[model samples]
Target: MRKVCCIFIFCFSTYTTFAQNVASVNGKSISSKEFMWVYKKNHAGVTSASQQELADYLELYINFKLKVIDARANNLDADTAYKKEISGYESALKAQKKTSPKNIEYNFIMNEYREGVLMFNVSEKKIWSKVHDNEEKLLEFYNKNINQYNGNDFSDARGRVIGDYQQYLENEWIKTLRAKYTVKVNDDELKKLAKL
Candidate 1:
């Protein structure tokens, strides 16, 4: 009876640990904790998680992992883009480890390059063109969301009003740009990944 109880306990522990390791890509396990962190970071304000959402995200992440592995196998990791991404992530990790001003500066530069350059280029080319506004479109947007403009005098929220207007314009531009790109995710693959 004692041996049987011990086996049961061991089985339970193993199962619990295995469940916590969500997926293994190229022998690298992505822990449930890591997955949760990524999920929360991407969905800051969301209150609920749908199964489909989980599946889709998991699939996308696994595909990305596979791509990274492939890239390394093909020696693409030595390329500038791969190196930049790795360096940025490495710098961020190092900054967290040593909290030094120099490390902080390194992180800032890495973040700036990623957010300002790479992200800006991708977003501008894909999303900006869609939302690009001519006078007609701007006027149309203003007309549609007139309630936003009808509030108390602009003097009070002048900065906010202008920022909103600019963002609206940029959003339209991005919408236009995204129309040119072909982007699709496999639902079946996503669902399968969620089970992993």
Candidate 2:
């Protein structure tokens, strides 16, 4: 009986080792062992990660890969504006990498402008563009989102609501603009990655 039990245990261990089908992209197979290794390479030693958290992160990696694939398919990679933006981002990252972490704050504040002129520029261009001073629009904005600007009257939250309403308007506008884009994720690859 003990010999039979040992044989059963050996067979089960072998089967379990062979059962893992790890690597896949959009339903295509990849090396399971390599996939697990890459997932661990990215995620191991993270203090906050549990087994489930590690699995979730692997799924995120797979989703990122899918998005990259779709982006390439749509010719977004060849877009001049995208190229410029990506190049600028990579250059900024490289520049940051050159500086020691201890000196990072100083570099970010002065050289990178932590919250200086560029913040103002972004606010003026992206955020402030949505704001308007017309009394009719203000009244309309207040009426549509009165709960947010709720108070005794316009006098109580005039300044607050104006900024809040403008931010809200910009957020909605961005969401609407995003509808022009299409996106999809591969659930199968994500699930397989999660196991790793």
Candidate 3:
């Protein structure tokens, strides 16, 4: 019957939509399978997440997306720093590609690496250079946190002191980034992920 065919077509289309899409951001589709894959990968050692925990992670994921979107909008994606980082990764991957021509895992790893490199490039431009360039500030930080170090000689502890100072700068920088960005999540779409 014509009605039966129409009903079947509708059901099939609905199923396809539900199966393929988890969420969309600024016209970008986030596939349910990919989202679930990442969720499982991140929570591999854990038993299971409560609904609240999953919801929290969904918000974090959205925030992460917003950050990436912001980074791209600001032209970080086109910057030499980001391009160089990804080029380095691609060169490394080229060596492995010879062994496995159809490696799905490498695609996911490359996605993670690309995003990581973008974030690192942004941080380097925004915070890392300032921290590294200020010798006076580094010395002041070393003097303030001198007790935390072990060796008596300042030269021996310079690396540790600089690392701690960089961490402090990074924390402060993250606060600024959080304030700068706005993140929104679609609750209806987020709930669908919980079912997976």
Q: In lDDT terms, how accurate is model 1? A: 0.55
After superposition, candidate 2 runs with Cα above 4 Å error? 1-126, 132-136, 189-196
CA lDDT for candidate 2: 0.53
**Weakest ten-residue segment in model 3 by summed lDDT:** 181-190
- Model 2 TM-score (2 dp): 0.36
| Residues 1-196 of candidate 1: C-alpha lDDT, one tens digit per residue | 9999999999999666556666666456666655555666678945356668876677655644443443344455455875677577767766676545465445444443443344444444443554454445545555566688766554554555545666765456444433533233334433444554
Q: What is the C-alpha RMSD of each candidate to the true structure, in Å?
A: 11.9, 12.5, 7.1
TM-score, per-candidate, Cα-based:
0.39, 0.36, 0.55
C-alpha lDDT of all candidate models, in order: 0.55, 0.53, 0.68
CA deviation > 4 Å runs, candidate 3: 1-19, 45-47, 97-101, 124-196
lDDT of 3 by residue, 1-196 (tens): 9999999999999667655765555556566555656677898745355557766776566555655666686799998867887888778888866535267666666776777666666667755787776888888888888888864556788788778988787667556655666433445555665655
Highest TM-score, which number? 3
Sort by TM-score, top down from the best: 3, 1, 2
1-196, model 2: which lDDT tens digit per residue?
Answer: 9999999999998555445543345544434444454555555633333446545665554444444444454555576865565557646766877655466333443332322233343445445755655567667777777787545477676787788777675566445433533333334444555544
What's the lDDT for candidate 3?
0.68
Give candidate 1 misplaced runs (Cα > 4 Å).
Answer: 1-14, 45-47, 78-85, 88-196
Which scores higher on TM-score, 1 or 2? 1
Worst 10 residues of 2 by lDDT: 109-118
Output the lDDT of residue 11, model 3.
Answer: 100
